[model samples]
Target: MAGFFDRFRKPEPEPVRAELDQAGYEEVLDLIRADHKVPAVKRIRELTGLGLVQAKDLADAIEEGRWAPFPAPGQSLADRVRALLSQDRATDAVRMVAQETGMTEDEASRFIDGLDQP
Candidate 1:
């Protein structure tokens, strides 16, 4: 089963590790810190200007305790979607869901629509 899934999966991206100035390092640290509200990928992009896969790989490494990014960026995907929807940003929510889950627009729409069910 693992082999089967691996065949379909995108090859893992190589990790990113950028040297940063104190202020720059601290900024990413704050973003990945236990209580920070900024998204990990966003912070990585801000610091290193890496593309999404690289940024996410770096963020994952930081999250695994290599860089004290432990408590993880204070928000979960569901919460983010809810936040966007609460702000009347359904389109943004759909776009975000599609990007994160690799779903088609129709599938992401249906997924978001599920959140509205009681």
Candidate 2:
């Protein structure tokens, strides 16, 4: 004597969402996956004393082409001077070009100096 009322309930499907940005942690993870020859993340963290998140962010920026990785802070002034010494007339030394380009010597030095360093 049961009633005909208990046989057709269906479950709802979960909503789909877009991929979330990796921030930095995920980006470092991606880079590690790409190149595992060296423990780069570990070394970088040790040298910079940056937190896991910051380190990862920097790594991500480098990988994404949003930032460049060169001209480490401890580089010598001689190297900087050498780079300025090597430029052609169009791209001469930072101080020399700064006068014509209307850019600050410090700014030009940093850019050209960085290129001079390894």
Candidate 3:
């Protein structure tokens, strides 16, 4: 059986085409499936010709498994680190998120804060 990390790993891409070309769809899917909301939303807008609001909704849906946000952000990643104080882990989490998503420290902090909370 897969662990939490494996569970969140994206399903294999099957070459389905969408509003965007296959490459574009795949790119959007890659970011969305990774749960990189901001960039995924921006990429969705570029690929799907969606407005900002639409893109956000779409990206959120992708995260939620609608396309899901089921596990909550960083919940799985932070699971092992939860032994530390939330504040302590917050710093580590920020670093981890920044490395994974290419967000700055401040941006990663905000996102990690959301995940760090119960």
Q: Please provide, for model 1 over 38-70, each residue's C-alpha lDDT reduced to its tens digit, 9 standing for 90 to 100.
A: 485787676666887776776765544334221
RMSD of 3: 16.4
Looking at model 3, report the run of 10 residues with the lowest lDDT sum: 63-72
TM-score of each: 0.38, 0.29, 0.35
- What's the CA RMSD for each of the models? 14.3, 14.9, 16.4
Instruction: Identify the leading candidate in terms of TM-score.
Output: 1
Candidate 1 stretches greater than 4 Å from native: 1-72, 116-118
- Using lDDT as the measure, the top candidate is 1
In model 3, the clashing pairs are 63-68, 63-69, 64-68, 64-69, 65-68
Q: Between which residue pairs do clashes occur in model 2?
A: none
Query: Candidates' lDDT values, in order?
Result: 0.65, 0.49, 0.59
TM-score quality measure for candidate 1: 0.38
Residue-pair clashes per candidate, as listed? Answer: 0, 0, 5
